[model samples]
Target chain A: MSDRQLADWRNHALNLESEVNKVVVGQQTPIRLITTSIFARGHVLLEGDVGVGKTTLLRAFTRGIGGGYQRIEGTIDLMPNDLVYHTYLGEDGKPHVSAGPLLMSGENLSVFFFNEINRARPQVHSLLLRVMAERSLSAFNSEHYFPHMIVFADRNQVEKEETFEIPSAARDRFMMEIPIVVPNDDAIMEALVFDTKFHNVDALVNTVQPDVLQFDQLNAFSNVIQSSVEASDTLKKYALNLWKATKAPLDYGVKVSGVDMNRLVLSGASPRGMSMMLRAARVNAWLNERTAVLPEDIHAVFHSTVAHRLVFSPVYEMRRTEIAREMLQGIVNAVAAP
Target chain B: MKTMIRIFYLLLGLNVAPQTAFAIDSQNLPDVPPGIVTIRTIDPVKLVGYTVGDIIEREVILTIKAPYKLIETSLPITGYEKRYKGQVIGIELKSVSHTKKENKDSATFDIKLAYQIFTNNVVAKNAALGPEYLNLINTKDSKDLVKYRIPNLDIAISPIAIFGQVKIENNMSPLRGPLLLSNVKENKWLKVSIGFLALSLLGLLYILGQRAWLPRMGGTFAKTHRKLRKLPQSPEGLKLGVAAVHESLNTTASMSVFSNNLGIFLAQKPNFSPMATELQQFFSLSRQVYFEPNAAHGLGTNPQQWLQSFVRRCRDCERGLTPETSTQKSGS
Candidate 1:
């Protein structure tokens, strides 16, 4: 595509972002990152405390994309088959199989939201991993397709009981872990409660055109965006250094205040995580209408993109996030700019 | 954290020091002895008339051609009289010599001896205290003795004595040969050959494992083969096809307009999607066939006719939308 077409496509994406903004307020960072993840054709993991608008953000983003959206509440009893079909005795007193939310969306599914995903059992997580990785699912001995789908999962942080944490392999399948914090700004909070228009999510989401972009064309568009976005050596180096630092923080001069640097690292981000970081960064840069990546782009998405990928030493179990954040900052400071 | 770090270092240091010290101490020990030879022999000779506790004297002479010193010596005996028969009968070593170029040498030994014999259907005991001597002399002609013997050297003497109230026995037979030797040689080459055979078998197994026999036996090979068979023959074409499918599912323009727009987009973004060309073609065809109004006007129809024809085409397309076929086409 020409530069003008690229610009127009980016503008169109921004317009979709604005449409989502109408329904969900004060989550611009997450909203933008989510949009980037969508264009990258990658899954996302949302982590936050309770009542942080994660669901609302995901719902609004799905509406902005204008395709079939399916949401499944993750529970301890949720099974792999539940994502495919519900088996029960109907009013006719006969056992029947009906399509679940995942299949109900059919081939047109563009967005899949899994809420409180950690509450789901590992068997369910494994099934979700397959769908997210292959964009297809096996149900009743047949492959169910979702060519344009992007999986958005939210994990609850408050409770540990009966919750099965998603394994590293499954977490790596997601391109980013966007943290949805409660907006600290009193004005945004006040506007969220007092604004009657914001209260009606359905009405607000309906403002965008339905099926604005064809679901099938997304891959092509993503390709165009990816190929067009160039990353400078300096920014690429910064990202790589950050990834290395996650694995070996001491080498990058990252000092976790109360943790032993030598013993604090169990495993670093896997190769998959580094690749996902670059993918997400490229899309983020593309959305900014920049042909090339900047250090600022890496900085903007570094924490959410990389923090959860780090595996801390068991000794630092209680301070994982804090140590990870410190290590990331140290990496940014230590890596020399070009 | 500081305490933890200190403790971690302390544990590591402690764990490493003992092994290091042990290794150093082991290295300081002396090397093991090697190449010392040992020789042992058993000589069986008749003691025709000897009694228990008798003081018997004997001597043995050995010829020497070179100078050598005797370090140490031992004599082992078996087969005694009475209850001690087939056990240690006697042992006697008199003396050793260091000599140079000597043709003959001799030494004397003393021991107590006894014998039992039968005569006229009555058991009898015999005892003696005389001397039987051997003289070693260097000679060219000597029929009754070895060629190297020294004259007038009383090297061997046997003295026998008996003490007990017992009848004398005669004509007792002496024990025969089959005296066991103390030294036995080990066949190292045989052991080495067996080890080599075992090592060769292990090497063969390693080669087989490297060739993936183990994985094949575990069924991973068959699974991988099945996965590979699903892949598209032309990767580039398949990727393009997938990209085209993505585009078709996403776009809303008429068939001609969409194709034209896609063509324009492809021209501008030549390397777009990196998916196979067949996939691209399939995607473009699906988009054009499913979403757009057919351009029958160029051939002979209006927009309404185009719409109806498009609807019919869409129905046909829907019928063809099998997940199996799609997965097969994608080779996934």
Candidate 2:
């Protein structure tokens, strides 16, 4: 891409970042990850406490980029077809069929946010993962396509009963599993509490000018940025070492407190996850107007991009979030930065 | 006011004026002895042999009858200029020594006289102890203080040799050395500095051990791990190990962390972030072992061994030594 086009793309990303920041007070990390994921042509899985503005951030994200926004709340009885098609009775006393939210937006779908995705049955996950993998769905007579879609999903973490977990295969589809944390700063918390506009998520999202980014250019720009951002051989070695550290943390001297090095990792970042990290890092470098991928760029996206893909020992599964944060941190810190 | 001032001036005048005095007639003292008492020079004066700065010596003896106290009035007072008759002798009386000896009939008193002369310009002349008399009084009512005189002892007064002819040395006489003093002393500052140095050494040792700057022997976590490791491979041993790791983490973070609050606890100590995964596993194993013992054995992980390593990591985090650093050191 030309320097001018790169600059324009960076401005659009910054605009969207700020536009989401407008509604989601003190959510800079989630906003940045979402923006990076958007530019990388990858999906994001947001996890946080209820009322942390995960949905609202995605809404503002869609509004900022001027793309079709579709939300589906996952439930125990939700079927795979429920996301693809809906059946209802009309005034004519005859059944009518219509495209579901996923198909309604078709090729213009930019953000298909799945709320409480864990509550959805494994069947729904299989369907969603397939479509997320292919960006298209097979209907009765034709194929419903969403070539520009980025599936943004969130799972309920508070309750565990009656929830069907998104299996590991489905989880690997996401580019990042970013946690939306509550703002700890008292001033931000007070503003979020006392500011009336911040309470109106719909209005806050409406203030954003739609279609600030050309979603159609997102794929091409992602490819160009990934190729243009030069990562040195040393950087590749560093990234490779990081990958090795995750799989067998003991081999690369990755040690987490309260865990054994030899038995800590059941598995590590897969090849797809590693490449996805590179892609995200490239987009990050492009956003920062850097022609080369810096170590800090990789480090910036490392935990979110690569942490979720790590599978810890079964005994440590419950601590995945923490281990993910820490083990990934250990890998990055253990591996030498180029 | 004028009249009062005049009266005050008249009183002041009266107070300042001199007045005439009455006199008392004194008669002859009653003699306790029939004969008069006289003081005579025991030895002739040697005035010619002494020069200026030399003392003139004289021996005087006085005898009186029994029960009569002789009062000698003619003795020269100390610091007074030496005089013979009416002439100043250019000498001063330096000292006087008196002695009394009891005899069977009368008490005899002996006196020694000394004088210092100032001038050496005098030619040979006659000097005297002069005529001295004593008063013998028996009654208090009698007239007293009668005159007594020391008799004159004829001597030739002479001057010293000419000043230039007498040679003088330029330096003073040889002097003695000063008294020896002890050298033994206490150094409070040195002692105090040594004390502080000892304390500083102890502080350095403590810091080195705490930071593991040097190789540390078994500390709290190490000892706990050892204790757990020594326990038999029983369910009780596994449970103990889990509890030990849990306690170590709680102590490190200063809070108890459940499976869910691992993030919260790790947040408190980012240094322990590396151990978050292990802590989670420990918590999960603990839950399995404590709450569902039946399912714990099949969980595949040996809870005891996992706890041992996890506890050690907590110790590492507490020491600010990342496992990678440890592994690097070990690898090296």
Candidate 3:
């Protein structure tokens, strides 16, 4: 792709960012991550406290990227088939079979968001994982494919009781796990709390222009960006260093104040996860108006892409977020940038 | 013309028996010499208050009538140990001297002797100095060998007193001893400790100089970090921050850090691998602030903080503070 073409793509991404920001104020990180994930053609896991605009951010992206959007509220009683088919009584007291959200959207389902996904059963999670991994499902004696589908799942970390936390296998399928943190700036907080438009979620989401970005063109755009972006040999070495640090930070001379490097990470980020992260990084580079991928671009999407893929030792699992941040910082601090 | 005279000498022995009375035997030699010699001891023969290691000295003067020459062979010599009644007296003769002078009618002889006492013999502590016989050969008449005696110079040598007690106040009190002579070991330890202190001082100075704590000692990134720390919250300060990073990076990489060879530079110095992204963004921010004049780099919050942190990391890289950068120094 030409520089001008990349610029046009970047402009579209900026527009999508602005459109999403209209409803989700000061959530620029989530918006950029979600946009990059969409361009990378990978699923995302959204995690944040309640009322921090996870749903709103997802809705804004769904509306901004013109596609059929589907949302499923997870519950303990949710069954595996609930995502593909629903059977209920009709007015004539006879049973009726209809397509569920996953099947309903069919080929055009570009964005599928599962809210409070941990509330769902493990069976439901396994089914979602299949849909996420394959992007197609055989339901009602028919195979349905979602060629442009990108799933967004949210887990309520506040109340974890009676919740079936997403397993590591399912979690690793996600390209990024973007946390929707509440805006800490006074202006953003004031706008969120005092502004009438922010009080109404539906109206707030409506402020963004529908189909501000062409969702179908993202796959091609992602391919062009990945192929065109220059990752120098040194940058690859830098990435390898980062990879090694994650696997064996002790070998790289990484030191986190209280955590033992040898025991910090049980398993390093997967190679598939690394590639996905690189893909997202390229898109981020394109968004930054660069034809060549820079180190910042990689860092921009680094933690989101790789944090969930890393398995911590059981002892550090409870303090994963705190220790993981340190461990990642250690990696960042341990490797030299070009 | 000189008159002829004959002299006779008398010697007496001392007794230190349990009876506290002094006894002397009076002997009269008829016409032995109407010119008998009279010997007077300058130092008293009966001595007092002599400690165990004390030396006893005595000077005796003998006067003889005319026509007499003192015998030189009668002088006491070193190694002459005195004994009392077959028991060893503590005194060992150190030296003795004999001198004679002629006068109008008489010849006077002076004799001097000294002794050092070593051990404290309990039986001999109060004993008298023992007597020894000397043969005085005549100078004129070579065949004449007269037996002469020097009376013992008695002195009281008290055993070294033990009148006081050594009271120890604490466990750290010094132990009594035959004092040790250890100046050699003390000198060696002193040299070692001084050398250690000197090395420590030198190391501290090196660190201070390397850290640019000393005046005019500019190390790598020393100026950069200092300027960043003292940077004012102004546009000019921001420019300075940018320029500081640029200059330091160029110096660290030993070349320009354009986008093309950034990898090559970092590859050459893998120590900077961890800071790959931060350095990239630092260049971006520099470009934005200086070239494009964009006040904001979309760095989320606190652009000044971002600049400061970037500058600090840049400084850390320059100084090899980070582990990745530290490897560079260690490799060499």
TM-scores, each model vs. reference: 0.49, 0.53, 0.55
lDDT against true structure, model 3: 0.73
> What is the per-residue lDDT of model 3 for residues B105-194, given as tens digits with 9 covering 90 to 100?
777788777777766632224555546444443456654444445577656565455334533242121222343587998999999999
Error of 1 at B203 (Å): 82
Error of 2 at A93 (Å): 1.8
Report per-candidate DockQ. 0.00, 0.01, 0.02
The deviation in Å at residue B205 for candidate 3 is 18
Point out where model 1 deviates above 4 Å.
Answer: B1-332
Q: For model 3, report the TM-score of its A chain.
A: 0.97
Output the better candidate (1/2) by lDDT. Answer: 2
Q: In angstroms, how far off is B166's CA in candidate 2?
A: 14
Tens digit of per-residue lDDT, candidate 2, span A28-71? 87788899999999999988888888888888888877668898
Best-to-worst ranking by DockQ: 3, 2, 1
Expressed as tens digits, the lDDT of each residue in A1-338 for candidate 3 is 68788888788889889888777888888888988998889999988898788998888888988889999999999998888888999999999999999988778898999999999999999888888889889876788888888999998777878888677788899999887777789998888888888888998888888988887887787888888776765467767888877899898677777777777788898888889988998888778776566666777888999888889888877777667777776676556654
Q: Name the lDDT value of residue A40 in candidate 3.
A: 88
TM-score of chain B of 1: 0.16
All models, RMSD in angstroms: 34.4, 21.8, 18.0
- Interface RMSD, per-candidate values to 1 decimal: 20.1, 18.9, 9.2
